[model samples]
Target: MNERQFGPELTAEGASFRLWAPAARRVDVLLDKPHALRRGDDGWFSADVAGVKAGARYKFRIDDEIDVPDPASAFQPEDVSGPSEVIDHATYRWRSENWRGRPWPETVMLESHVGTFTRDGTYRAMIDRLDHLKTTGITALELMPVADFAGRRNWGYDGVLWYAPDSAYGRPDDLKALIDEAHLRGLMVFLDVVYNHFGPEGNYLGRYAPAFFTDAQTPWGSAIDYRVKQVRDFAIENALYWLRDYRFDGLRLDAVHAIAEPGETPLLGDLSRAVGKLADTTGRYIHLVLENDDNAAHLLDARQDFPRGKYRAQWNDDYHHAWHVLLTGEAHGYYRDYQHSPLRDIARALGSGFVYQGEASAHRDGRPRGEPSGELVPIAFVSFLQNHDQIGNRALGDRLETSANPRAMEAALAITLLAPMVPMLFMGEEWGSKAPFPFFCDFHGDLAEAVREGRRREFAGAYARYGDEIPDPLEVSTMQSAVLDWLSREQPPGRERLALIRKLLSIRQREIIPRLADAAFGRAHAEDGGLLMADWRLGDGTTLSLTANLSNQDMPLTAAHIKGTLIWGKELTASMAPWAVSWRIG
Candidate 1:
C-alpha cells in the first residue's frame, strides 16, 4: 500500500502529524498541551509527539488564531468542526484477508445512502442488509460520500474533511466492519467521492492554506487548484486512502467535468494512473468510475497509446433521461432535450454509449454535448433508471413508482437490468418502496435558511403548485422520510416487483455476465408507435437482442428479424403488447 502523504503516521513510539499550511506563520498541534511544529521550506508543518496515541483527540491552532480539524483527519468524534481523533488503521483485523475482489463485468451496483438505507442509519446497521442485496442479485454496494461533514445528518455531498469517515454514520472501525462483512458475503463495496469542491460550511483551508483553491468556481463552491502540486497530491492521496484503508472495491468520482484542472497532466488521469499502479501491486481489481457530463470518450478509451490512465466506465445520464421521458412523459428541465423523440434516444443510448454523441442539446441552449462513444465496449456505460440525483433533487423527492404506469416502469426495469451495459438500482428500487429521498442536511442559522429557500427556487414549477408541501432540506423530518421501508418487500406489490427483479438478475448472472468481458454494440433502431429494437455482440460469438414497445398502443412485432432463443420477458408473438419487452440470446 502507498504511504499516505497527509494525516498522522503511527509508529511503535507514538504518532507523527503533518499539516500543509503555507499561508500560516505559526502552527501548533493542540493536544493536552500545545506542541510547536517545525516549518519546512516547502510549507509543511510537522511535529512528532511521543505521547500521542491512537485514541487521542487533537486540533491544529494556526497563527495562534482559529482552531481547525486536520484536513486529512482519520476520524471526527464530533462533527466537522470538532477535534479530530487519531485512528490506528492497523488495529482492525480483516476477516476476509484473502479476498481479491470480483471482476468488473460482474458488477450489478446498488447505490445507497447510509443515513437513509435503514432506520438505524449507521454503518453497522447496513451490515444486516447485506443478505438482502446478495439475494437480490446485487454484486456491488455503492455508497454516497461519507467524508466528515457539518452537523449530524446530510445527503453527504457537503463533506469538508477528505480523509475522515463521517462520525454521523459510525466510527472508522464500524465502516471497516461493514466492508469486511460485505467481502465475506461475496459483495464488493464502492464509494462516491467529491473532488470538484468542498461543502459550504466547516471548511477552514482558506484560513491556513489559501493556495489550495483558485479563482475558478464550481456549481457548489470554489474549484480546487489542482495545478499546485500539493493540492493535486491531497486529492490523489484521498482516493488511495479509501481504497487502501477502507478496502472499497471502487470509487465513482462525482462530476469530473466540474473539476477545473487546466493543466497538461489533468488530475483525473494522474489519479487513475496512481490507482492503476496500486492495483498492479496488490493484484486486486480496483475499478474507477466517473460521472462526467462532458462524456469525454477518450478517458474511457481502452486503446490509448500513452500511459495516461483509463476509467472503467461512466454513469450514463443519457440512458436515464431517455428512459425517464419515455415512461413518465415529463419534459421539464433536461427532460425536454429527450422528449422530442424519446424512443429514438433510447435506441441510440442502448446501441451506442451516449445519446447526445456530438449532438446539440436544447437544455444547454443548443450547445454541443458528448463525444462519439460507439466504439467503446458495452460495459463502459453504467445504465440506471433511478439514482440519488434523479430522485432526491425533486421538490417532493417523489420516486418514479409513485407517478409512472406500473407496466411501463416494469418494461424499463427489465431493459435496464438485462442490457449489455452495467446496471445500478437506487436503494429502495428493488421492492418499489415509495419513500421520498428529498435533499436533507443538518446546517443551522443562515446556511439552513439559504438551503431551504434555495430548494424552493430550484423547483419553482413544483413549488408553484404544491406551495408549502415541499419538504424543508434542513429539517430532521426530511431526512427521516427518506428511510427505506423494509416491510414493503413483504407486501404483495413489493413481492411481485422483487420477484421480477430477482428473475431478471438471475438470468443476467447465468446468461449475460459471462459474456460481458468484451461485448460490443451491434445496432439499434426505433420505429413509429414507440417500437424499439437493439442488439449486441457478446464477448463470446453469441448475439443478445432486445425488442420493446414502450408506448401505450400495441405495435406489430417483427419476429422474423429477431432470431434467438427467448431469455426473458414474453415469448415471440405476432404483435407486441403495450409496454412489452423481450430479450433473446443465440
Candidate 2:
C-alpha cells in the first residue's frame, strides 16, 4: 500500500493506502523528486511519509511502467485524461460523530438527482435543506450517481472514470460536507453508482491501457473487461474508495444485469465481499444496493454459498409499475405487461419482497422470478410510486403528479409511505411539483447531436402523436425544467395536501417503524375499483392497518372484523373523505 504524499520517508504511519495491480507482476513504489529509493517485496511497495503529508503527489509504478494515479484516488481534478492526487479523509470536520444509522427495516428513502434538487446543483448547497427532509421524516437520502462522467452533467449511467468524483458537485470536500451534515441530521446517505458501462465521449480507457474493457458489449457501449484480473481489481478498489474513504452509508449499484463478469468468483460477488469486509473493519454500515430486474431476492438475503452477501435492498419496480399503470392508466412498452392493477399488488410488494414471484407473466412469456426463501427478511425491499426512470421515460417527462388525478396521486402517496416495504419519495413528488424531468444533457457539437438521436431512438417514438421527431434532449430548457422550485405553493389546496404528506410520513416513522422488522403480515384486501387495505399484526395482538379509498364517492365499510383509530388522513376534513387513509391501531 503505497500512498502518495510520502516524500522522503518509507511508510505512512497514521494512514493506510492501497492500490490494485493484479497484472503488474512486480509493483514498485517511487517518490517523484530527488528521492533515491525503489520499492521491494510484500506484493505492495511502501514508503514512510512522516515528513510528508497530503497535497504532495505520487502514483503506482507497475511493472516497468511510469507513475499512474492511485487506483482509489478520490480527487482527480487534473482530469482522468491528466493525473491523480492524494486526498486526506481526516481533513473534513464531519459533525456526524453522534449519528449512527437508523435501523435497516425502518428505512424511508428519498431519491433526487444532485443537479435538479436545488438551483445551485451542488452537494454543499443541499445540506442546508436537510432540516426540510428531517421534517418530512425520510430516514435515508439516495443520491443519484455522482461518479466521474463526461464533463459534469449526466444521468450518471454514463460515467467513464470509475474512481474520480465529478467536479460539478463542487470539490471532493463539498460532497464530504454534504454526507457529514446528512449523518448529523440522522439521515443515511446512499449514492447511486454506475459500474455497468462507461460513457462513449471523453472516455480514455483505450488510451490508458488496452485491457480495461472486453468483448462484452452492452447497449450503452463496451462493457468493462472484468474477466481480466486488473479490471476486477480496479472496480473493486473503486467500490471500497466510496465506502472506506468517503464514508457513504451505502451504494445503489446501477444496472447489475448489464454488467457481465465471468470469473472464479463473479464480479458482483467480489464487489459485495470487498464492501462487506471493509464494513466489518470500519464499524460503519456499507450497504450494497444492486439494481436487478431479475427479481432475485436471495441477493438481499444472506446465503450459505455466497457468504459475502451484504445487499441491503433493491428497488421493487413492480410496485412502481403497478401503481403507475393504475393511477395514470398509460400502458406502453414494459408498462404494457402490467394490466389493470389491483391495490392487492402494492400490498404484496410491501408485505412480500416481490409481487411476480412464480406468477405467469404475459410480459416475460413465462412465470416471472421468485423472491428469497424465508431467511434474510431483515433486508428492506424498497418500493415506490415513481423514480427517475419511471418519470423520465415518459414521452413528456411528466411525473404521475403532473398527470394523475390529485385524488389518485394522494392515494399512491399514502400507499407508498405506509407500505410494509421501505418507501421512496421521488423529488418534487412531495409538493406535487409540476416541473418536468426531461432527459437532458449539455454535450456540445457532434456529441450533443449523437445524444439527441440516441435518446429519440431509445424512447422508440412509435406513437403517431409525435409525427416526425422528438425535441433534442441536449436543449437547455430540458435541464432547466428539471430543477426543483422549493418555494411553497401552499396558499390554497397545496397547503393541506403537503401537510398531509408530512403528517403521513411522521405517523409512519413514529408508529410503523418501531415494529417494521416483524414479517407477520396480516391479510391485504382491495376491491376492483375503489379501496385498498393491509392489516399488519403487531406482537401485542394489536393490529395496525392502512386503509385508503381512491374513488370519487365516499366508501363506508360496515365490516365487523376491522376496527381501529384514525391514525392518519390525506384530507383536511374531520371525517375520512374520498382518497383518505387511516392508520388504524386495532
Candidate 3:
C-alpha cells in the first residue's frame, strides 16, 4: 500500500507526523505537549512520536506563532479550523470485501449532496436511502465533495482540507459505512473532488506555504500551483486517499477547466495515471470522470492505446444546456449558445457527443469552445438535465419541473435515460420532488453578507422580479428546503414520475446497457418542425433509434421509416404529437 507523503502515518511503535512547510523556519506538533518537528533540507518537518495513537488530536505550530490543522488531516472532528484527528486507516474492517465495482457502461448515476440528501444530513443517515436508489436502478451514487470546509453547512465546493471528510457529515468511519452499504447493495459510489482552488475561508496554507498557489485567479480563488512537485502530490494523494481508504468505486474531478495547470503533463493526466496504477494493483474496475467545460475530447479518447491516464468519460454540459433551452426556452447566460437551434444541438449531442464542437460560443465573447468529439463513443459523455450547478446556481434554485411543461419534461427524461450516453439524475429527480437545491453554505459575519450580496447581484433580474423570495444561501432554512421528501415518491404526481423513470431505466438496463461497450455514434438530424431523429450502432451491431418532438406544435414524421422493436413510446404514425418521444432497437 502506498502511504501518504503528508499527515501522520501510523507505525508499530506509534505515529509519525510530517508537514510540508518549506517556508516555516520551525514547526511543532502540538498534541498534549508541544513536540518540536525536525525540519529537513527538503523543507519537510517530521516527528515520530511514540505512544501516539489513532483518535489523537493535534495541530501544527509554525514558528511558535499561528497554529494550523494538518493540511492532510484524515479527520476534522470539530471543523476545518479545529484540531485534526489521527485515524488508523487499517482499523476499519470491510464488509463488502469482494466488491470489485461495476463496469462504466452500467453506470446510471444519482448525484446527491449529503447535507440535503436526507433529513438527518449524515453519512449514516444516507445508508437508509440506499435501497431506494438501488430499487430505482441507480447503479452509481455520486456524492458532492465532502472534504472539510469552514462551516457546518456548505455545497462542498468550499472545501479546504482535501483529505478530511467534513465533521458535519459524521466521522470517517461513517462515510466508510455508507460506501460499504452501497457496495453491499451492488451500487458503486463515486465522489466529486475539487482541485481548482481552496475555499475562501479557513485555508491557512497561504500563511505557511505560499508556493502552493499561483498569481493566476479562478472564479473561486487563487489557482493551485501544480508545477510545484509537493503541491501536485497533494492533489494526487488526496484522490488516492478517498478511493483507497473509503473504498469509493470512482471519482468525478469537479471543474477541470478551472484547474490552471499549464504543463505538458498536467495534473489531470498525472492524477488519472496514478488512479489507473491503483486499479491495476488492486484489481478493481475504478473509473475517473471529468467536468471540463473546455470539452477537451482528447482526454476521453479511448482509442489511444495508452496503458494509463485515459479518462472514462466527462460530464457533457452541452447536452444539458441544449435540453434546458428546448425545455424551458431560457436564453440567459450559457443557455444563449443553444437557444438559436436547440433541437439541432440536441441531435448533435445525441449522435456525435458534443453540440459546440469547435464552434464559437457567444456566451464566452465569441471564443470558439470545445474540440471535435464526434469520434468518441456515446458512453464517453455523461448526460443529465438537472445537476447541482444547473439548479442550485439559479436565483431561486428551482428544478426543471417548476418551469418546464410536464409532458415535455417526460419526453426529455425518456431521451436522457434511454440514450447511449451514461445518464445521471439529480437527488430528488427520480420522484419529481419540487424541493429546491438552493446554493447554501455556513459562513459568518462579512463573508455571509458578501455571499448574500453576490448571489443577488449575479441574478439581479431575478431579484427584481422576486426579491427576498430567493432563499438566502447562508440561512438554515435554505438547506432545509433542499431536503428530499422521501414520501413524495409514493404520492400522486411523484408516483407517476417515479414510475416513468423506473420504466425508462428498466428498458435501458434490459436493452441498452447490454450493448453499450462498443456502441458507436451513427447519425442524427433535426427536421424543419421540432422533430429530432438519431440512431447509434450498438455493441452487438444493432441499431438504437430515437425520434422526439419537443416543440409545442405537432410535426409530420418525415423519417418515419425507423424499423426496430419499439422500446418506449407509441408506434409512429404520419404525424407525431407534441412532446412525443420514441425509442426503438433492432
Candidate 4:
C-alpha cells in the first residue's frame, strides 16, 4: 500500500482514519457518534466525516464493542481506544513571527502545568502566562508529557496512546494552535513524549496490531518492539508525524532506559537519526531529549549512539538528583547514594558532565562511572532544581520541600540560572508556587485500590527520611496539593520571589558573567560545613559561592582566592543571611 494509505491520512474533510483488522470481519468509524464504515476487501475500513470539523471527537465501533480512544488520537478524553477524533493541524494561525530556537547551549527553560500556570488551563489561557515567562526571560518551555493519558484528572504520563493529544487539556488543533501561538510569542515548546512503554488502563493498540509490543518489561508495561520492522517504522514514523505534521519544536523522551531493542544500532540512535532527517526536511529544529539515568557519555556524542550520538542530548538526572538532595536533604531511594553534593558536583555538571562516569557508587554496586567528559558543549545537559518526578513522586509531591528558605532557595536558583548549563524551572517555581505537583493517576475500581496500595509500598521502602507518615500517592490530598495558589503572584512574598526569579532569568538571557561562561574552576574546597566553588582566572574571575546551613548556626564563606561581583547573601553583605548564595563577576 502507499504511504498515504497507511495510518490515518489527513483529508479535506478533517482526517480520514483506517486500521488493518483482518482478524476482525467488520469495523466502523465511531465518529463523535456511531457511523457504520464500509469495510474494504483487505481489512481496511474508511470513514470520512466531513463538516463534522477538525478536533471533533469519535470512537471506533469495532464490530460491536466500544473500547477506549485511538492510541494515536491527536486528542483523548476516555484515555486510549475509547473514541477517535479528527483534527486538522494546518488550520491554526501561528503568531511567533520572530521566534528563533535558542541554541540549546543557551537554553533556559520554564516548566509548567497548563492548569496551574494560569487560572485557566486551556492552551489559549497559557498565552497570557507567556508574557510573564518571556519577561522572566527563559527561552524555552517544557510541557509535562501530554500524550493521550487516561481521564482528564491526572499527570500527562500514563498516556495510553502515543499519538492522540489528551482531550482533558484541549483538542489536537488547540495544541497545534498553542504551539503556533508560542512560536509567535518566541517560546520554543518541547513536548514530553512517553516512548518507553504505553500506559496501563486505556491502552488498546495490541488488539488492532499484532507484535506491537515485546516482552520487555518496564515500570509501566511491555515496551514497543523496535527490533521488529513494523513497530520500528511506527515508532520512527510517529515521531516524524508529530514534528513534520504537528510542527512541534522537539520531543522529550521519557525513561529511555526502559527502551529495549535487540538490534545492533539501538532504536534510540535510529530515532535520533530519523528525527534529524525530518528536521532537515522541514527546515525546522526538531530535537530529541532523552531522560536517561545510565550516565552514558556516548549518548551525548554525535557519533557514539548512532551516526554520532543519535540524540542531541540526554537529561542529566544526576544533576537533578545531586542538586535536589543537596537542597532538600531528603535522601531516600536513589537519593541515598548522593553523599557529596558539594559545589564541585554542580561545577562538574556545569562544565564537563557525566558525574557518575566511572565513579564508585554504593547505590550502583561501587562500580566507577569511568569517563563522562569530552562532550565539550556547555548547557548540553538540562539542569533543574525541581521536576515532576523529584517533586511529585514524593509523599507530599511538594515543590518547596521544607528546605526552600528564601536564602537557600535564592542561592539554589542562582546556581541553576547562572551556571554554565541549560536551566529548567518547574511550574510555579518562579514565584515560590505552593502547588505540590503530586503524583495523580486515575484508576477506577479495583485498580484504584491497587494503585493506592502500590504507592504506599513504594514509599514504604524510603520511609527512613520522612519517617512512617508518608502520604499515599493516590490520596485525594495528593491531587489537591498540586493545585497552585493563583493568588500567590500578587502577595508580597510572592512578588519578591517572582522578582528574584525574573531578574535571574533576565540575566541568564542578557548577562554574560564569568561563572556563567567559565569552563574550569581554579580551586574547589569542600568542608563538613559546606563547599566553596571558586572559578579563578588570570586577573578577575567569578565564583558561584553557595552555602546550605543544615546545622543550627550560620556557615561562613571561606573563598578568598577568587573575586567576583557580589550579588546575594549576608556573609558578603549585611542584608543576606546564612544558607545564601552570592555571584561575584570577579
Candidates 1 and 4: which is better by TM-score? 1
RMSD (Cα, Å) for all candidates, in order, is 1.6, 4.7, 1.4, 4.6
Global lDDT scores for all candidate models: 0.91, 0.68, 0.91, 0.64
lDDT of 4 by residue, 1-586 (tens): 1243344556555657766554555677666567666778656577665656655676666558645455456665555655566656556665654443544445677777764455556777776677777777766788877777655666777876777766667767677777777777677888888777877777666676547788778877787777766567667777777776657777788887788877556877778887776656545655677788776666664222222336656677777776767666767667766755634565556546656777787776776653565344444567788888878777767676355566667777876777655678887788887767767766678878888777777766655366545655555565556666768878988889889888777665555432333333243344555544534232124334333333234655444522555554333532224555555554
Candidate 1 residue-wise lDDT, 483-547, digit = tens? 99999999999999999999999999999999987789999999988888999999899999999
Clashing residue pairs found in predicted model 1: none
TM-score for candidate 3: 0.98
Q: Could you estimate the TM-score for every candidate?
A: 0.98, 0.84, 0.98, 0.84
RMSD, model 1, all Cα superposed? Answer: 1.6
Clashing pairs in 2: 9-48, 10-47, 10-48, 11-47, 11-48
lDDT of 3 by residue, 51-109 (tens): 99999999999999999999999999889889999998888999999999988889999
Candidate 1 accuracy as TM-score: 0.98
How many angstroms is residue 258 displaced in model 4 relative to the true structure, after the best TM-score fit? 0.8
In angstroms, give how far residue 557 of model 4 lies from its true place: 7.2
Worst 10 residues of 3 by lDDT: 301-310
Model 3 lDDT on a 0 to 1 scale: 0.91
Clashes of 3: 0
